[model samples]
Target: MNTYRKTFKFDAEFPFEYKYRDATSAQFELPNHVHDWYEFVYIYSGRGTFFIDHSFYDAEAGDIYLIPGNTIHHSYPVEDDPKRATAFYFSAAFVHDTSSVGEPFHYLQPFETAQSKQSFRFTVPEAYRNQIVDLIEQIHHEYSEEKVGYRQVIRMHIQHILLLLNRHAEETWGESLLRHQAAALPQWIEQTLSYIDSHLEEELGLAIFARNSAVTPAHFSRVFKRLTGMNVTEYVTAKRVMRAKEMLRLNDRNIAQIAEACGFGSIPHFHRKFKALTGMTPAQYKHSL
Candidate 1:
């Protein structure tokens, strides 16, 4: 299986997008992929299965899945009972801008906590499901109509929806409504991922990871690929490129310095890998920003 990054182009002014899908839709399927925007999938009806990062969950009517950016996931409707759902996608900046300083509540707490715990599936109480649906419908209306001040209307509704979910999480802190599955990745693999992230600037290779994990390189490679859908080299290079993108956007670091900090051996090598993953040279990406 080939797991690739999925990219979306959002409007600079309002970086939020919405999609609704029903059984009759031609392509109501999700392939294994990761993206750079937070997402919410609300199941309007029917049933399905959702695969997120290291576990799978059974999805049904009234279910809501919170997917944080950069997490790999896939969803498919059941053969006998297809699912109909609405998806909301927005950027981190959108959430940050909506928040005020010294505010006690966080708009992204549900998503952030879910990502950390590998538990992405949840369902509100029966009484609140309608309200959730109503808010989402309002957002859809504002988005579709695009009348005067529609963007502000949509933003308010989006914030309201997030607030509802956050409150639900708070009210039912340890309830069964929040479904958490057993992690599918082995303990060692999980540790390896953490290690790679913290030590991105260090020299990284298959042999080093395998040796550190106390397994043969070939065996480690097979298990890693099977779980992540990417070979070790591919995963490492992708991570480095992602780190490079962040540095480019946030700092004034030159391309060569960023490349060195991101573990690429040379500027030419960095250029090749960055363009291969992101469809633009480093300079072009920076200029676009």
Candidate 2:
């Protein structure tokens, strides 16, 4: 019941957050939730089960996971031997702004691939594990100190880490270790998610979906919340807003047009929801880009 969307007030100039957990415990267990920032997690020691998207993966020392923005995930640490891990979170804008022309490097390729395949965990070759850890630690130190030029140095380290991961993904493409099978979701839930994505411009209601699934509205509401960590209304609103954002980025359409295209009832309602989730009005978000 405590599951809800999480938001962080990242620094406008440098939108990155880092954390290290010495030992995870019951009190630290996170319920299923989603966030609007990409995440990179490095397991330093111990063991755990990580639920990412629709899959559960066994996590152990030296394992790494890349989670794209707005993905549902949670971790369950083994009681006797909890996981000690480091997490790095950064905005998509941070990656796009740092990327240069003709670099032949798409920093987000690994994350994109993981999202497409629903496989987010990986391990670098034994020889490269220490190097990756060192770079992550350097990012932690620079971020903690906040000395002069720390922002630039931290950015360098993050890009370096991503570059290494992307290379590993390319080298190991289609390998068994890189393609863990995800647990299948309930048929109705999976179909509902796909339906929502394809029909964002149409009216979406719990009653409609419930009827389609041959369940009572109240029953459908409870089960949807339990499975997705979000109620039907919240999920639909989030999807509409996400689509609006893409429209804002890809075209010069007016806010009102974009809002209508995304099935918002009105401009004011769209503005309210967009600012609530993204911390900025639709116009402000467009201008920020």
Candidate 3:
């Protein structure tokens, strides 16, 4: 039972997964810098301007901007117009590994950068964008309510909202994929993840997890792979690697202990995966980063 759970200050959270709303300001206000994780800012009802990757864009209601991790970006209100926007943040690895391909949520990039900065951006269809806004507003409403096990509920809704973004992603690639066709993700992906974090060292496998997530092995594997861009086994490895990296950098645990704590079957396997993902091995990365 590996349950991953850690809380961060509102000001500093990465692999941060939450929805928030901000009121429009009369004066321009923004700081130019990148965070340790990714950010998605959705304009619900706002007239504003954004500076992303050194380029500018008009931020109107229904606009969603995808800001990659460590990619410089900032914002400012549109003169005196009232505005309301919501945002969510996480890491690329929070979504998938380096080897994973396919721009599932890449469509939200700010287009003004494409010509000048050569970055790709896509627009969420007006209809779908409306759906996303509704989802976020509902999620925030539920968040304020704090019903039973609200954390877990919000996580599920957030995942559902992500499924919407995932659809937009496919559309951006000129591929039309419906929500049901978006590839079913595990119902317990987040639950299983929460458990995984708490019991990182527990020996976990697909057989038991099949029951845990309440799906048959075949269906579970299919949905898990489609959503995560990795098979269950690979996803576990990636999770372990991320845990290892976090431990190595922030905790007092040494390499061997951290590897063991993160549930690597062996030290060699951990090191191998570490090197493959990062150009440098864990030891090298820790010292460098």
**Candidate 2's residue-wise lDDT over 192-274, tens digit each?**
77788778889999988998888899988987776666688887887787788779988989999999999999999999988
Model 2 clashing residue pairs (backbone): none
User: Where is model 2 more than 4 Å wrong at Cα?
Assistant: 1-13, 22-36, 45-62, 69-83, 92-103, 116-119, 142-151, 174-181, 214-219
Per-model TM values vs. the true structure = 0.72, 0.76, 0.47
Winner by TM-score: 2
- Put down candidate 1 lDDT per residue, 1-289, tens digits, no spaces: 4456677777788888878765633254545677778999898788766767656677778888999876667775676778888898998777665446776877888898787666899878877788888888888888789899998888778778888888887787836557875456577787888788778889999999998899999999999876665789877887788789889988999999999999999999999998876778999989987
Query: Residue-pair clashes per candidate, as listed?
Result: 0, 0, 10
Model 3, range 165-222, lDDT digits (tens) per residue? 6665545653332111111324476566457556768787777677988889887777
**RMSD, one per candidate, in order:** 4.3, 3.8, 18.8
Q: Which ranges in model 1 have alpha carbons more than 4 Å from their true place?
A: 1-5, 9-14, 22-34, 43-63, 70-84, 92-130, 141-150, 168-181, 214-216, 251-253, 287-289
TM-score of 3: 0.47
Residue 175 alpha-carbon offset, candidate 2, angstroms: 4.8
Global CA lDDT computed for model 2 = 0.79
